[model samples]
Target: MDLAQRIQKMITPTIKDQGYEIVRVQITGAKHPRLQIMAERADGTCIDVEDCATISRSISAVLDVEDPIEGEFTLEVSSPGIDRPLTRLQDYQTWAGFDVKIELKTGIDGRKRYLGRLLGLDEEQRILIECEEDEPHTLAFEDVQRAKLMLTDELIAAAATEQTK
Candidate 1:
């Protein structure tokens, strides 16, 4: 229903047809909005510049016909990168055991942010994070406003291992 969701819906098929999965779609700025589309290879390989260009072209074609935006906007296509935003529930599972920073839509016990090791999702699909405290914290997935992997040596090594595979 929102701009990003609309854009994602419009371009998802095209992107999937090209063997890519969209990671996230975001529209920012007021004067000249920027449409940022983060995507990854469906095969789990690293995305390259050529991949970005191909996705950009495909998305541009769809947007050109749909004319979704009221005014001029910039379309950017890129990979999720090493420190990627966890936009989907699957992302949490995929990146489990890594350090992450999660921000909630509303504070819990006067705390709005959490930094800890991701323990993946629980049976109810709620997020499980092991903070510095004694017990792990359980958060509702829907309550998470934004979350991203923390850049660390372990993450970098994991990314390298994945790329080499």
Candidate 2:
């Protein structure tokens, strides 16, 4: 098997047993290895850093013992962060109503990039993002080059700051 596949196979279950989901495995240049593992409730809301760090250290230690690599490699374990990657249909489903950025395979509004709120996702796994400049663009999940949540702490705080605005 390939390196990433091998690592995932070895590490995923151990992580899952500890209440963490191995969202994905990323290996770049065979030297820098990062595992994007997310800890969430069964319903899938995000988890805090304490849990993430605990899981990270434990997973790293398990990997160290497994000796998946023949030589040197780095294991970085952390949350997916605010601009979380959209790697699965459920990921899109869970984050609906939140602002996100989607990169389509081809241009929809004379450009390839779109940033807006995710209205909803359908059974076909198409992403429905309501852009600022146009209607809700439905791009097939398979067609998404990259998708992630948009950073808007100010936006979030504004909503929380003034109950009546």
Q: Each candidate's lDDT (Cα)?
A: 0.93, 0.72
lDDT of 1: 0.93
How many Å off is the CA of 9 in candidate 2?
4.6
Per-residue lDDT of model 1, residues 16-122, tens digit only: 99999999999999999999999999975669999999999999999999999889999989999999999999888888999999999999999999999999999
Worst 10 residues of 1 by lDDT: 38-47
- Per-residue error for 95 in candidate 1, Å, reads 0.5
All models, RMSD in angstroms: 0.9, 4.5
Off by over 4 Å in 1: none
Off by over 4 Å in 2: 1-6, 29-41, 61-70, 105-110, 153-165
